[model samples]
Target: MLREIYLSTALLAAFGLVGAGLVALVHMGTAERIEANREAATLARLHEILPDGEYDNDIINDTTVLSHALLGGGQHLVYRARRNDEPVAAVFTVIARGGYSGDIHLLVGVRENGQVAGVRVISHRETPGLGDDIEASRSDWILGFDNLALDDPPMERWAVQRDGGIFDQFTGATITPRAVVRAVRDTLIYFDTHREQVFTPIPVDPTDEEAHADE
Candidate 1:
């Protein structure tokens, strides 16, 4: 009995070590490819948002913790769109809570002029027929927000068509769409308020500051 237990324990330990080694090796081998794919996807998204010229930096999260942008001005905005040295986009992945069914995931593009360039629905669990219309594929309703400026009108003016506003709300699913609209508006407002801070480079750590002071 003692010999059997010892053998079992040794086998388990060996298996655990092998499993850990495989995991580490897989991570090491795929890290570069995963990063490259992320960079490619980010660049594609940025181009879809700007589509004007080539950008060099990955300025995502520069404006907001969850956002990024490419920082050159042309006919359209060009953001370098990078993560570390790997290129990516200056994009925001926004989560709008309070939807009728639940939360909605939206990716919103903000132009340099503080206008909304476009919005894409990343995911949602709203009432299928009623709330899904907010998606780009189901309808063009979400596109109504494209190029809308914050100062264009009052908050009341941002409601859906059923509520007598510029946008349209689904027949029975008003709350879900309404939540998304409000969230988008709030995000834009946040961007406008923090534009300069978002675009600027993050401050270096205190260690760097102390080194400078010493110098």
Candidate 2:
């Protein structure tokens, strides 16, 4: 009876190992394809904010992760665009933390000359009709950021009109648009302060290279 019990335990252990190996194999087999699909989706969105013809490089892969208070205090991805090897623009995925409901995610594109190329709301929890107008589909308000600069409206006047600024706020949902304006301005400031680092290539980890080689 003890021998039977021991054999049963061994068999169960073997099965567990086999199951884990199969999962790992499946993940390894599909990992590259999964990554490719994610990259494709991100590239499509990036093109929406910054035209594909504006830059010649592979903007999707030309990215770096950064964190700063001006960028909502957590790691955010930054994509760089170049024309003839010269910096053209940088797109930042910024988070607006003062939204009426919660955080609002934004993709802000700023050119090398400091003008805003474009801005898009990736996600938001603002009110349906009022705050939701910040979206391009809901309204063209987000497009007003194009060609704007910190000095264009003056740093002090970057808030919504209700706050004595240039941009207009939603009639019933002031917090949502206000948060987005602040976040975009903050992203521009971040880009201005970190231009060199923003365009610099991310260093490759030796371990990562070795792992790829092994694969």
Candidate 3:
């Protein structure tokens, strides 16, 4: 009976190892294709928010990820679009955590001049009817942010009407809209202050160049 038990255990271990190897092989084979699909979808969203003919550079190739307060204190991707090697616009994703139900993810486009080109809610877990209006398809409230700037609405006036600002809150959801408004404001401010840094090209390392040459 003991020998039979050992044999069963060995068989189970071998099967587990084989399953893991197959999973790894599948992952390795599909990784690049999956990444390509993801990148394409991201670029589609980026172009949707940016104004037509605003940029000609390969925004996907000129991307950077940073962990900062404006981006919900987590890693966020920032895409830079340029025309003739000159900066034209920036698209980035940010999160608003004060939603009615949970955090809201937003994609924001800002022109080189600091004005917002457009904003879109990538995903959110806010109340179904109230917070869902933040989406462009459901309501036009998000359109109000187009062409907005820091001083146009004024930093102090970046709240909903109940708080004496210009934006309108949903019929039953004040917290959601207010949180979104503040998030856009913060994202704009972050880009405005970091404009030079954002547009700066990353310097190639000399050591890496030598290593590549050796290879």
Choose 1 or 2, whichever is better by TM-score.
Answer: 2
Candidate 3 clash total? 0
91, model 3: CA deviation in Å? 1.2
TM-score per candidate, chains pooled: 0.67, 0.81, 0.81
- Per-residue lDDT over 15-90 for candidate 2, one digit per residue giving the tens place of the 0 to 100 score: 9999999999999879988998998989988988888999999898888899999999989989999989899999
lDDT of 1 by residue, 1-215 (tens): 99999999999999999999999999988998898899788656555565534344435433334333221111222243433444333345677778887868777777667778777777899888888998878988888887887877566777766776677677878898887787777767767776665455656799999999999
lDDT of each: 0.68, 0.92, 0.88
Model 2, C-alpha of 194: deviation from truth (Å): 2.0
lDDT of 3 at 120: 93
Best candidate per lDDT, number? 2
- Over 1-215, each residue of candidate 3 has an lDDT whose tens digit, in order, gives 99999999999999999999999999987998899999889878887798547787888888888677987878998889899989998888899878898899999888899999899999998877778999999999999999999898888898899999999988889999998998999988898888887788767899999999999
Q: Which stretches of candidate 2 lie over 4 Å from their true place?
A: 1-30, 204-215
Better of 2 and 3 by lDDT: 2
RMSD of every candidate to native, in Å, equals 7.8, 3.8, 3.9
Top model by TM-score, which number? 2
Q: Candidate 3, which segments miss by more than 4 Å at Cα?
A: 1-29, 205-215
